[model samples]
Target: MDRLKALAFTTSLLALVYFFTQTKFTLSSIQWPTSLFGGKQQPDFSMYKSLSTLSVQEFPLDPAQSRRTVIIGDIHGMNNSLSSLLDVLDYHPGSDVLIHVGDIIAKGPHEGSMTVLSYMASHNITGIRGNHDQKVIEWRGWLDWLHRFPDGRKWLTALERRWDEAAAGGADPGVWASKQMKRHRSPWWRTIPKDWKIFTEHYKIARAMSDAEYRYLLSLPLVLHIPHAHTFVVHAGLLSSDPRYKPRDPRQPLARVPTVFGSAKSKHGSDVPKLRRAQELALLSDIEQNTDPWVKLNMRGVLKNHDVTRGKDGRPWSDIWNRDMSRCGGFEHDLSFDDAHTTPNKHKMLPCHPSTVVYGHAASRGLDIKRWTVGLDAGCVYGRKLSGLVLGRHKHNDLKKHQSPTPTDIPFGDNFTGHVVDTECQLE
Candidate 1:
């Protein structure tokens, strides 16, 4: 009986060895069953990837175009407020170019994000990606990757099931996770934290998104340049220029100015002069290349040392930008021999053009309107006001006067005038 049992065990061991050797099974080789997850084929991961930095989109400056340019601030999923603000602007679809200043979706109502996204997509509106939008994109990307593997799908399903169970029991998922960690005493439990529920909404939003919506989010750039308006639209703020590199001659084309005179070709451009169009192209190229992607999305201050901070540690970047824009160009200032010696970097102290930057991430400041920078975020998600900067060719008299008390008329391009219009938001 013992010999027979040993034979059977040896046979089973041989069978197992044969199965592994013949099949060559591996985690990578396992195919996720499509039927398990809506029967949809795996999507091309690259199709939904977001650009890190230097993604720029420029609109042609048509002199004859009478369309108004409306730059709106952070919506933060306050779709009702957004709609009311547009109504207040008397927005005309064919005659107005709508540009959002990021944070269009997230944090307000449950359906507000998708509603705003759908509206923007249908209207052909464009804008930069906000920090919140980035988080949603990341979650979607993670979910997409996980859905490509059977085990990953199972894990996500289990998490969802657990979340549902916790919700049904009227228990906080974070608290429940803490208890599980204590009971299990396993390293895997550590992966689930007490604050995991904070990201649950983002995960839910990502999962509920359609392909078109996901694609739209992925298409958003870090910086949007409006050449004719002499404006840049970003989520947060931008530095004037890199302090490490000596300033260039504002009088000459950016491409012709060398980093260090006679050292080598300019990092910005070739030694040869570029045409007006080429120069325009080089402007954003230089700025986007020098600035980090994160800085463009969250910068609030620029330290004295030229370092940027997302916190309130230094001077507001807008103040620095306005300072740079207001300075006299090197050519405008004449220096004597003694003065030149005293200010060795005098020639490098050229001023930037009075270009405008419309940004929206700093809601705490609320409706910041500077000479060269406009901050339109008015904390709409916090039951404050939704703000917008409307630029139109109509004369001040011809433009429709909005009833909103927040409207402030301001000068725009050579032929355009702008107004800061806002409406009260419903408390979430």
Candidate 2:
């Protein structure tokens, strides 16, 4: 009986040692209270996975404070352009607030993304998620999901090599993935290498991202509101149809709208052939009128090729945005929170002050500056100037004296007060 007892103790000690070695946790480093029985606690990734699509952030500057607030559009890995633009603006890091519209990476110099992320972190900048940024999150999320299994890192590295090799020969990774998915339809996830080829060139950048940088990217909200500046910043554009449209799942990125809008790839997702030309025109009219986003339920009403009406240079989503959400009863109707201090949720239907919107992601039109809506993406990756919008602070007494204008009374045309700042692109 004593011999058996000794053997059981020895086995338990060996198992504990193996666990410690596997997890890299030791008795000296472990927190006594939380590490009950000396076990390593796994991080809870639920919050990150379920992050909100819309986040309301306030930067209420004291009326007495004097500072500049600037919003920059799609960097697209243009570090030199960003640096030059800041120089042109005479950016004062300590006294200024910087906000970045998305697409901070992709389709440009690979080195720029890391530089941009590092700069934003150091400067304490706020940002929204661009489509490219969403692509990064999806890719990163997929890789992370794979890492839960054994030999995942090895598989990911090997898969990266495969993607690089395919791209070297002028092959489209997404097409390749589509073919693979089609061929193995029963269990798609198993066949997929957990690598998305659309962002093949960005894999290294994605992999090299530090934990904090990854968190920063993942934490980016889809929409930003600055009441003081009367500005709302978004990656692409907001929907006027559902002024109060909250996503069915806040966990999903807010910029994703299922329609024939956006890049060419997104154009092919739905069946638009069924709708007649007149029907298509009516849907466009409905969209313009800020009616329901979907004319019919189950995504069948709108014509898929309706975007062609906007011509080669697509119609700006802002052009169709008929109302200023901040002023209209709309902002109040849409927000989920009940109070000014509380964040919105699904259950809450609260009123919010409307604000002007400044957005990027539409580069074909380039530097579209309307009275209420501004598109700052000047296609920096395509050798266009990177743009910034500068809003100077209003003095305390001036702010008090400033009367808020009614929605219809808001000034338009040349009288719009914001300034557009730009810097020449430096492409290699």
Candidate 3:
């Protein structure tokens, strides 16, 4: 019995050594789920939420100061179009403040996207977190882990240089070598190096990215509040039930701690595979069946229910936000946009006060402009036009004084426009 025990231990140790030798790295070298959206990495929803909500910024240094806030819609890496739009608006750098409605990267050329970000950073442009932007940020974390070690950095730098040379049509067929990966059929997956396929396709872009650029994306806020304009800007719509609604930090996680009910009762079956599938579906149904009006789904939820929840329809949160201003957690009276000297009420007590929200996550419906909300994702990366909402200083004052007693009927504050992009591009 003692001899048998020693043999088992030896066998286990040999197997472990063989595994590491075959993989060309130790188990510690493998950053599990290093790919975007958890390729092989374990999903830690809490860590994801914390990293995602790490940044939130307020608009207007002083509400009383003269300001012209220009809020642009999703620019899915269309730098040329963004430049054209800014020129059209004749953007005044010092006096006019620029804000994006999220989705700052993905879809366009990698280099172009970097340029756009550099421009925004230099110009002090800020935005809320869009789904695409969120995905990229998540990808950034994995890339950071991959490149953290010296050996990893050396491997990545060599790979990135090869890719860049191949992309430029150099004699070396660096990009050609990755063709074997096409059998997998994921464009993202194919971009990863052969030995390093454990990581994400975003590695190519991430390796090329400067540290400052990554930091800029890390600093994105989930929501921006404009006190003078009485507006809240987010990449997606707001859920009043969320604790973050009141403070609205972009760097904070938006999802609540999922309440776990007792496991659903299941009938025992001889077919183990069938039983497992049934269990998965049952768990999914429980999450989907949650009746809360403000339960916001993260990327994982959407991907899981992409097929299951199809064809079902419900009213958008903005459309149903017609309750009294006080009930909606809004001010009793309109704040003066013209007065930069005016301060917000410190002792004001109120329930959920609904304000106008400007967002851009819904691209399928295109630009959805309503009385209380503005959806600006025009699917530009899908070959549609890149849109922008210009909120002039004069319009700010005009809307502030003209607040309708009926909150639902409040006028849309910004002037919307789109720049046409003829070529169709894939959505990230």
Candidate 4:
């Protein structure tokens, strides 16, 4: 009888404690996380119920002479490619118009290249936002996307410990990290001499930008209709491929396309592979009907297989929670304008708008230097090669300014495209 009575008393006391504590806890607690979005590098997409169709679109059409307009593809972060391309085009700054296809960030030799390239764009270049550039914007929460990394956890704790001190002291963690990386400065980051390190480390991304500038970059239309050549210029090509584009709504913000559920509009989103996937599928009928003995397989052969490759490692990392583990995680889209399997004949490119399309998201290995996009994106950051395409009256093999080879090329470690181009060095 005594034990039972004690037990009942304790239970009653606990109930009273819970009832009384509820209000106090509610009143005293800190703010609930209303901003569900993640940090600059990651964000939460669940906040938006549906994705807005508002992906990028094309700029106004250009009307002029019968001359051709050069369109380049993804640059990633390789400013060297851009430089060499300009040199090739002999771009007269104001006279010639160059269209950068997309992807202004990620992968390449230096972060600073973006800064330099941005400066160049303000002066002469115009561009489209590639999947990587979109990723950069989306990663920063410009567009709604699912969150993976926990909030404010982009940096390791060690760096976080020194963040406030660095920020308060007007020190940058990335610079400090690079300084501390003194000894470990991988062969890649140290290719350029130390004298130029400060300006060069982030030279590409550090050239001061204005709101008008970034907005200008963002404002650039994905498609550039050239009435001059009767051609349409685009970054990764339209997903629908029919040219029947639906404009994204202006009022509401757009949402991220979930990797698993697929997109209601199309399986592919803004990513390069998705755009290509749609094209491959659309072209299948043409490939299948190739009755000619010379023609190879049609679009089916190219579109049938899914691109398993993505991310820096060239592996799929789109949505881990969604895609099946068994699916091949290494599907890579072809970089060159033309591929062998597509046409069913010799290696040939799609019938590009004869006027011109220039792009460079892809990198390639070189025999001598870090050849920018041998096939495409020739390991630039790894000190391989910086790549770009110069479209100055594209008259075939003649347009390319051929230069003889030197040492810098190899399969292994050191022998990289150590060749440097100093654009920012100001002379007294």
Candidate 5:
């Protein structure tokens, strides 16, 4: 019996040695054994809400009453560039509303992110969460989780000290993380791929973040709906309709269309009612509830199968969005094979209102402006221009040349126009 016990102990020690020496392990590769429970696990979103709304009441759209709504694109911690851009715009505090389209931090100078976060917090600036922002949030959450345990607190303190040393020595965080992963031999690190090593910077930023900065990131939603501007601001593009719905013939008219403007007479010639506010909000909410949160943060295109993908191989979501927005009603007749094949619908397409989406995250395309959609990510981190879409009653004649004219089909009625403005950024 004593011999048997000794043999089992020897086998366990050998297994541990094999795992530590032969395997490429890291702390991040740990996974919960949910598969053993025999059911798929749903993502926990209790910590954050997916959607938020902003109205003209909070941010007045009138130029006489307020300056303008300056919606900036993927900042990527270019604080200096951001200041310069604001200077060029002649931004007025308490008068003008500033909104970031996300990717606010990461991929730039470390101090720049903290500076940007401090500035945003002080100024009450609000925006949607980007993919990079999400990564930082996850890291911060992990750090918070670790802080609850005695050993974890020690482990984190050591990790932070090591990071500080790496920074002081001018070592790249990605290189440092790679070395640390190998040295630590934690099973979690083995699951990470080489390309994802860039996330090491994200981890560093997360750990360095102040409580205020972390809360600011946590407060941001995946989508921000502005009722008065008839615009939806999101980190990435939004689908025109539910992907599950079948495609309708663009040529067909709706069975029942909502009235956009009321005919009530006002002091000014006629009273143009709110722009289908209810329908637009419902549409926004529907998309938010149905689509995966990750899709809102990373999607660039939609596949023919109606699945949203981060890859550029699929059809540009903006194109489909513009096509769908141009039409106000649903199809009356059954869709033909040609119609179905040409459109991005696996199920029936419903009526759509002429709503606009102001988004970032697609820096590769850079400064996409359409009648119904505006993509403001101009790759500022890559030394390209940092873009902003200014929407208000005030018109900048200089920016007119850059602005896409509102489509004749849509009735915006001169309440506001979206003008694209940008400034050059320095290479990080």
Candidate 6:
């Protein structure tokens, strides 16, 4: 009897504690917070895979390609800084061929910033599509996602259904997003930005591309080959010998798309075509499947093919590998967390242009200098500022002193995870 009484008392005490704990700790809703996406939930490889990989005409040379050209790094939407960098470079209308690596949109100042990119695109800046560029593309594929998730889709459809029923109609994304910010606590929920309309607008661009222009952008080679200069240019990274196999750009018009985009016989696996085209990317169901990204354009929607050689420490791919030439022999690393050397699963053409390959997809924040790697992306998206290499003759040297352009404020990665402020620091 004594034991039974004691057990009952303890049970009551424990129950009381449990009830209090539940009252104090349990949340009434499972909403995600907006801060989580500030920089955490980047786009997956599948995002990049969705964008139509583009290829274009033989780079005419800098008098066509330039005496040299200015190859800038990735700009995750840091628009203000991007403008400053352009100013410092003394960038004129046709003096140089600008190779923008990628990540031009999505993060940072994606707002009025469209005007900048649109201007460049209209002028034929040769902007290579980055992974961020693809995330929006992937989002397009899932346009009806709001009506897809179990709870989310149901809630959305409920509202829309109700409106549709009365012919009142459509939920405003801004209002919905504001509510999400206020109510969501899920980590994934926070990844959205306050100005998500930028996504819709960008989609409109891709969706509305003139049949010719759309095909042209889609036809852009994953790598830009400047043969006269012996230079190769890509948004992220490249291998030595590019694959001769070419797919017609699935974009509109489709007449101009080329079969083979660039120089052949690369050392690395950068020549793989899977990650370079939009049609190929759509083939994938998820991002984690593409672990080894030979080149990643955006964190989201990136579809990559692991460079088998990338797993090897020294002298990665033999195709793009030049026993004599140096730069980009191994996989890229991730320093944000464990500093583990995680290689991407995508690839691009190699021996771009020719000898002096200009690139902007690879960031140098983690690895100081990757082996045999000549990365031009200076991580301008993370508030670190932007950088661009000038393939031009220097005033000091008549024999072509490679002119290094001053970093510009292209505003590529400013709001990488929707963490932008009203304004950011100027690079100049």
Best by lDDT: 5
Of candidate 6, the 10-residue stretch with the lowest lDDT total is 413-422
- State the lDDT at 163 in candidate 6: 39
- For model 2, where is the 10-residue window of minimal lDDT? 293-302
Score residue 118 of candidate 2 by CA lDDT.
Answer: 75
Regions of model 2 farther than 4 Å from truth: 1-64, 161-195, 242-315, 322-354, 393-416
**lDDT per model vs. reference:** 0.66, 0.54, 0.49, 0.35, 0.69, 0.41
Mind giving the per-residue lDDT tens digits that candidate 5 earns over 1-428?
99999999999999999888656465324333232233654223225557888977655667565457778999999999898777767677666788999899988888898788788866668798999888888777766754654554665577667778778888887778878877876443432333554337687688788888888888999888777667788988777666555335232222123344444312222222342564565465456423577777888998888778899789888997777676543222223322545656533444434678889999889988887788899999999988876666455642334432332122231246556668889975
- lDDT (Cα, tens digit) per residue for candidate 3, span 288-388: 32222122211211222222121124445445332222233222222222232453542232312234667776777776776567777777777775666
Residue 306 of model 4 has an lDDT of: 30
Alpha-carbon TM-score of each model against the true structure? 0.74, 0.57, 0.53, 0.40, 0.72, 0.43
Q: Rank the candidates by lDDT, best first.
A: 5, 1, 2, 3, 6, 4
lDDT of 6: 0.41
Worst 10 residues of 5 by lDDT: 264-273
Q: How does candidate 1 score on lDDT?
A: 0.66
Better of 1 and 3 by TM-score: 1
Which portions of model 3 miss their true places by more than 4 Å? 1-66, 150-202, 227-229, 241-314, 322-352, 395-428
Predicted structure 2, TM vs. truth:
0.57
Write model 1 residue lDDT over 227-314, tens digit each, in one string.
5556778889876655444445333333143233335432233332222223334455566522466787889887777677888678
Candidate 6 residue lDDT tens string, 81-120: 7676666556665555566766666555545235445655
Model 6 / residue 194 / CA error / Å: 24
Error of 3 at 35 (Å): 15
